[model samples]
Target: MSSSNSQKEILTLIRDVSTEKSQGERRVVNLKRQIEELQSELESVNAELEDAKRLKECTEQDLKGCEVELAMNESSIQTLEGRIALLQGEVSTIGSDLEALKVSEDICFVAGGFRFMCMLIKCLCFEIAWTCWFINLCEHAFRMKNGLCDDFIGKMFDLNAMIRKFHQSVDSASYEAFSSKAVLQNVHTENAHTKQVEEGKKDLERELAQIISDTEKMEHEFLLEQNLHKQVRSSP
Candidate 1:
């Protein structure tokens, strides 16, 4: 009677141990499935993160290109402005020289007096030579004022056109810079970074860790029950 009771007790303990082991295995399987699901979600988030990074790179490139173009346009505009100033200075100098030549021509005519008359009467050839030389000087000064002055005006027109072109380029570059800034701002505003996704991933990781811990605890409990079953069977 005692042996039969002992055998019954051993059998009951073994059954209980097996049942717990089976339940623990099931829990482990479920935990593994949960982990796989979490990993899949993480992969999807990572893909989205990669796309956002690529878009940011492209926007940065565009912004840098626009900035370089703006710098070049600004430098060109400054150079044109300097050239215009130099040209204006040259024109002013030319005007002053023309004015002085005119004053000299007038003074030559004002030198008419009895002494001049006597000299002309005494030396007609000499007076004629002096008069012709003076006329030639006046004519040369007039040619320089007319011909070269027209050339300067033409150059000034060319400079003005260049200045206009520079201004147009600056305007275009400014527009491009503005457009690029808008694009960059939009990109940032869209918030295509990984902050939110990282939070989700962290949540999944914690859940997976908890599941694994619970599964391990279950396994430990199952092992303890198995040991208890063996001890019962070996009892005297």
Candidate 2:
């Protein structure tokens, strides 16, 4: 009976060793599967990170472009402001010149001045008319060249044009008023010059008549002296 129990014990030890080896094989297989799963998850995460990096670079480039556009817009605004200031200065200078022209009412000619007055008035009218037409053309050209037909651009031009038109109208009215005043003064000067010329012509005619009368009187006195000498010689 003791020999039989030892053999049974040895058989039980062999069976237990076979079962543990089988469980160890299953654990190794599970570990390998888990490693493969972890490796796949790591690869997926790395791919996602690379895609995010590419998106970040694209976003940065877009932002840089936006900044550049903003800078360009700011520079354009500054240039427009400078142009407006220069235009204002030009308007002011034109206004002053118009005022000076309005105040200059002195007549330049005094004697024999009818033809002269006609010529002067003709020249002044021609110059003023030409200047007004030229200014109108210049304003129109500026509007066209500056894109002033657009609604937004037209707004700037409208403000400037309105101011210019208002001042120009005032100046034109002043010029007209001065012209009226000058007309009366010029007429008076011309009349005075005409009267003086007529009087001088009459004086010249009177002097010529007196010289002819004196010469006729001298010829009559010499003829009377010659007749007295002839009578004296006949008596001898």
Candidate 3:
């Protein structure tokens, strides 16, 4: 009886040991599966971090490029502004010069017209003096031919005076005509200069307009780039 009891106790102890060993093996397998899952998650997180770092570097490069472009645009804007100011000043100067030219042209026209009128009057006076001299000479010749007893010496003196008067009238007429011509030429010169100044003003205006257009385009591009940079900075 004592031997049988001891064998039974030993068998019970062996069964308990076997059951504990099986439970321990199952727990170890579960822990190994958890470790593999955690390792996979760590590798995925590391890849995402590398991608984020590369993206940050690219974003920094883009920001630097944008800054450079913005600075260039600003410089261009300043240059255009200066050009616009210079053009405006030139236009104002041209306008003033044009006004002066117009006034001068008007004065020249008035003077030329007056000179032409004076020339016409002087020519008419010359014709009248010549007609009077011819009539007097013809009368004297008729009297002499018919022996009318006219004072021949006095008649000769009168004819000489008339001839001298006719010569003076002719001189005056020629001088008036010459003066009129010179004044007309001056008027033409002034008109041509005015036309040239106007053409220059127009060219300046066109250049100013083109510069303004270019500035507007650059400003728009700058705004777009600035907004893109802001978005990039705000991104996660």
Candidate 4:
């Protein structure tokens, strides 16, 4: 009866051993699936990071182009201002010449009078031409200033907004990468811990299997001894 009870216990142990092995296998499979998911997330985050970098580079290029254009516009404004100054000087010189001719007319001899009349006519013509030229210069200066002002204002606004956008994008991309990296690190740490636990469980299972094998061998020896005793008693 004790032998039968011992046999029953051994069978129960075997069933428990099998169940533990299956559970271990299932745990390993679950861990592997988790690792795969984490890896996929990491790859997706990296791709997004690369795309953000490319966009930032493009924005930088655009800003550089805008700066060059602004420089050119400033140069044009300077040139126009210089031309306006020169036109003002020419108008002043014409006014001085006209004043001298008036003085000459008052001091007249007949030849001097004739020469003075011709000079006056010439001055009048020059004044008309100078007035037209001065008006044109003023118009051109106004146009150049207005155009440059508008262009500078518009370009500056665009550049500033773009720069801010680029910075925001860079910041956002960095933040995303940092967050992903942190998650990856956490997943890796969990995997490492899980692997260690799995290794420990395997060791424990191996030891348990050895113990069960030894117990089975001992149980077989006990059964053999019991059968021999029974045979001896029956033969007597």
Candidate 5:
């Protein structure tokens, strides 16, 4: 009986050992599966971290570029401001010159008009003289054929020479008138050019102001991005 009891106890021990070994095997397999899942998750997390690091580098590069652009804009804005000041000085100078030109133009206009009027009167006198000479010559020819007097021909030639001299004097006066008109036109052209230059300068100043505003805004955004990158880097 005792032998039988001992054999039964041994058998019970063997069965318990077998069950415990089976449970241990199952637990080990479950732990291995958990480890594989964890490993896969770790690999996924590492890939995401690498991508984030690359993104951070790109963002930093963009911030650096923004700073460079901001610096350049500041320099350009300063240059444009100086240029605007120069243009303003030029505009003031041109205004004074324009006033002087206006006075000169007015004076020249009256003188040119008088000279042209005199020239016209001289031309009329020449025309009248020519007509008289032609009529006198025709009459002299007829008188010669009819055997009459021809004493008026010499006098008519002398009168025509006097008219030619008067015409030449008037032509010389008209040259002065033409020169005055050309000078007045040149002054007007210069005034117009100066005004145009002033307008262009104003446009450039406005454009530079806009660029400055945009560059400052971009700089602000760059600072914000830098801060965000710092926060992200320190988060973990």
Candidate 6:
């Protein structure tokens, strides 16, 4: 009975040892699987980190480019503003010059008109003198041919008076025409000069408008770029 009891105890010990060994092997296998899963996760995390690094580099490059573009836009805006100011000053100068030119033209026109009127009056006087001399000669010839009579003499005197009256009227009409023509020409020249000045002013306005439009466009682009830069800086 003592030997049987010892054998039974030995067998129970053996079975316990085998069961513990199996459990230990199962635990080792579980640890290996967990290690493999951890390795895969680590690899995935490393890949994600690489992608993030690349994204950061790209974002930095884009920010730098935006900064450069913004600077250029600012420079362009400044240049355009300067141009607008210069054009405005030039316009003012042009206006002053035009006013001075108009004054000079008016002075010149008055002087020229006076000289022309004097020349016309002198020509009329010369023509009247020639006509009077011709009429006197013809009257003398008629008296010599018809034997100087009172009736003929009276008729000749009446004719001489009528001729003198006609010549006076002609001289008055010619003086009026000369004055009117000079005034008309002066007005026409002034109007033409004004038209030219207006056209030049319009051209300057158009150029200024174009510059302003370009400046506005650049400002808008700069604002958008600035906003983008801010967003990039604030990004996580």
Residue pairs with colliding backbones in model 6 are: none
User: Evaluated with lDDT, which candidate comes out highest?
Assistant: 5
What candidate 1 gets wrong by more than 4 Å, as runs, is 90-236
Which portions of model 5 show Cα errors greater than 4 Å? 105-174, 177-236
Count of clashing pairs, candidate 2: 0
Assess every candidate by TM-score: 0.33, 0.39, 0.48, 0.38, 0.48, 0.48
**Where does candidate 2 stray beyond 4 Å?**
97-236
**Clashing pairs for predicted structure model 2, backbone only:** none
Give the 10-residue window scoring lowest on summed lDDT in candidate 5: 192-201
Off by over 4 Å in 3: 106-236
> How does residue 30 of candidate 6 score in lDDT?
99
**Model 4 off-target regions past 4 Å?**
97-236
Clashing pairs in 1: none
Alpha-carbon RMSD, each predicted model = 39.5, 41.5, 22.5, 49.1, 17.6, 20.7
Cα lDDT tens digits, model 1, 1-236, are: 99999999999999999999999999999999999999999999999999999999998998787667656655655555565456555555645554553434222222222224444354556446656765775576567856576665675577557656655655554454335433443343334222323333454456555655555555555555555545544653
User: What would the per-residue lDDT of candidate 4 be over residues 1-98, giving only the tens digit for each residue?
Assistant: 99999999999999999999999999999999999999999999999999999999998997787667556555654554555455555545545554
- Per-residue CA lDDT of candidate 6, range 103-188, in tens? 44343344444545665686678678868876886777765755656666687688678768766866774565456445545575
lDDT of 5: 0.68
Relative to the true structure, candidate 6 reaches a TM of: 0.48
lDDT of 4 at 90: 54
Better of 1 and 3 by TM-score: 3
TM-score, candidate 5, is 0.48
Q: Distance from true position, residue 130, model 1, in Å?
A: 50
- Over 1-236, each residue of candidate 5 has an lDDT whose tens digit, in order, gives 99999999999999999999999999999999999999999999999999999999998998787667656655655565565556556555655554565445454455566657778986888788788868877776776754344455666678768877887888777876667666655665566434534444455455555655655565565556556545544653
Give the better candidate number (2 or 6) by TM-score: 6
Worst lDDT 10-window in candidate 2: 103-112
